[model samples]
Target: MDEQLMLVENLDMCFSTGKGNITALHNLSFDVKKGEFLAIVGPSGCGKSTLINILAGILRPTGGKVVLDGEEVREISPKMGMVFQKYAAFPWMTVRQNISYGPRIARKPKSEIEKITNHYSSMVGLEAYEHLYPKELSGGMSKRVDIARAYANQPEVLLMDEPFGALDDITKKQMQTELLNIWGQENKTVIFITHDLEEAIFLADRILVLRRPKEDQNSLNFIQPVPFSRPREPELRTCGEFVRLKAELSEVMLK
Candidate 1:
């Protein structure tokens, strides 16, 4: 097997409330290999988003550690990029500007920024709309812009928290195809979080099923490998193997 690119060791998260402390994640541990796509699926309160936040260094875990490339991660690292559930585009910025934001902040030369912005915009099929503001784009288009913006930075590890959850079924499927293509070309390690079991199976090389934080100290219920061949086709969703895995995952979630 490939050496682990990222490791989560006995991670825990707690938040204080008026009533008392609330545990959002409990002793969760996992490893992600370089260039692999991993999906996290669970019930609504199962700490999926909380786990992403911890990995991104947006929230410090109460216990345990995150190690990336053999070093413990204490804060946000340039090697990571995040795409939130919500459309994170700036309304005031044009698509080009939004995609170029990261490179600009990193003090990249204007020529380099323009080159990356153009490449990613075209990759996400947003070249024609590069000059358009966020308000003018549809939900699907806005999501594409968000993806383009993330890729523009060329982070080695990409974290997506229910990125396509808000799109319509048709649009979501299209975006999934687009995402897979981008993932293939970029070759970055990806950790995707979603509540949809089918979507998880369709996109991940491995699926991590999380349990509600209150249910157990070991929040990770299981880690199942996806057996489908790469460059998966839409037809694979109806195949027997895919159906069986989905059924198994559904049962696990409901239990």
Candidate 2:
């Protein structure tokens, strides 16, 4: 079997509010296999975002480690790329420029930058939009740019935080199909964090659940596995197997 691409072990994340320190995740652990599509879901304030941040090395964990490949990284590794919940595209830059921003910042060879940006623009279906600015684009269009920018870096591990949160239902579903196409084409390890169970079920090979921080009582701890088949169809949602799996996961989510 292929090796795991990322591993989060005994994770503990806490935030310091004016009130005091609030523990967000307690002893959370999981592994993401290479080329696998993983999703993390939980109630609000369950530290799911924090966990993603830690894995991206954007935020430091109070305890535990995010090991990629065979080693732990002290800073954000260049091999990891991210798409935030909100669109993080640069309004001043054209679509191509935004997608090429990372390579530009790294001072890559001009020839290489052009080659990569052109390829990514076509890959994300934004070739025509390359010359356009973000403000000229729709909300969904901005996200497409964001995804293109991240993938243009050719990162082996991708971290997406509710990338479809802002789109309308129709646009959101379209984006999902687009993302699956991209994932299928690249076959990289992907970790998607979201609250939408249906979305998770459709896209994830495995699902991780982070228990809510319960001040009133101790939090539940565990990651749930999703055994649905790939190239999931709409009818899968109505199938007896899918129905029972979703109902079970929903029970855990409501807890």
Candidate 3:
């Protein structure tokens, strides 16, 4: 597989508050290829979102660099679609309207917008709900809408910051399975952040583990080549290899 994206060399992040200077990320580095699912896991405030924010161009790093398709990340665009922990769907808009927003903002023609919206709504299994408003949707329905809108824009990279974090366990699992199905069809490069070990193991082609320091420092422990096969089977979670990998990550994360 060719490398479509990478964070080459050392990457750093810092912030200055009223008290003093703070460094959120230190020497962060990783590489991802096309159609790969990469998951980043760490303790809360260990700079998971900080790293993501930097990648999204929402927050520029204080030092180092990021290389996307051999270029620096200068701005955010539909080329990268972000899904947050909360369903950031517009409650006032119908599902179709919400999905059409991105294409419209890009000044796409009405004919093109309709084509993409209908395609994405069906892709996310939300075709029947396109006319429904957010208030009429269930927890699962709302999340599907958010996902539909994100993918409709035809992003090359999908950045999900614990999208299932707000869902019930059962619903979360169902969404995970649904996501894999959608991904199989779309094949976009994915970077997903999750605190759940099982979630990382289940979804990632490889996992990047972030470390938190007792004295308030940040570091990384890279463990690649994780054997998470595509089209995952529910029974795989019970397999010894799967449990062992999950256990190994737990041991490192605890300190």
Candidate 4:
């Protein structure tokens, strides 16, 4: 079995609104193993993005702790990288410059930045478009650049918050395949957030279902393992087992 990479214990988040305090997450807990792909699914207002933000150290939990490789996470760490739903490419920067941004910010040598940029640009199939700016790219191409930029940072864990939610179905499927291909090569631990049940089943090693907190319930409803063998092909989405799992998760989500 793979070693545990992260542990979230009794996590909670609350916001101060004029309507008074709103609790976004309530006593959420889970663990992610090294190199595992874990997908989080929940309805709107169930705190999925809030959980991702807390995990990224972008937001501090009101209670509980996030332990990464044994140490408690109090602030952002280079071991984690995020890809947002919005394709957050810098409009002024070319593809090469965007992908190399992290390394450059860390003051890596020019030679090393060039090597890292070239490697990841090719990894996401964006090598030929290295000179292109964000406006020149299509939706799918822009997302590829986002993935490349995140991975170029060489994070131990990658957090994606509905990164393909903006794409059409066909493009979303294509990007899923592209992402899996890159993930296979790198084997970095991934925590993916999505509302699409099929998308969750298709990509994750395990699926975490978070329920909207009620008077008597905790935020984490349950965790389900994906039984499908990986190197998952696009056609796997149509398989009987995949369909069954999707249906099961859909039911869970609707509850």
Best candidate per lDDT, number? Answer: 4
TM-score of 1: 0.95
| Per-model TM values vs. the true structure | 0.95, 0.91, 0.93, 0.97
Note the Cα lDDT for every prediction shown.
0.91, 0.83, 0.84, 0.91
Which scores greater on TM-score, model 2 or model 4?
4
Which candidate tops TM-score? 4
> In each prediction, how many residue pairs overlap at the backbone (N, C-alpha, C within less than 3 A)?
0, 0, 0, 0
Model 1: colliding residue pairs: none
lDDT of 3 by residue, 15-119 (tens): 899999777888877777888888889877788888888888788888888777777886786677988788889988999999888998899998999999999
lDDT of 1 by residue, 1-255 (tens): 376899999999989999999888998999999999999999888888788888998888999999998888888877888898999999999999999999999999989998999999999999999899999999999999999898898887899999999999999999999999999988888999999899999999999999987644579988999989889988999999899999988988998
RMSD of each: 1.5, 2.3, 1.9, 1.2
Q: List the residue pairs that clash in candidate 4.
A: none
Question: Who is ahead in lDDT, 1 or 3?
Answer: 1
Per-residue lDDT of 13-81 in model 2, one digit per residue for the tens? 778999999998777777889998888888888887777788889888888888888888567876888
* Candidate numbers sorted by TM-score from highest down: 4, 1, 3, 2
What is the RMSD of candidate 1?
Answer: 1.5
Cα RMSD of predicted structure 3: 1.9
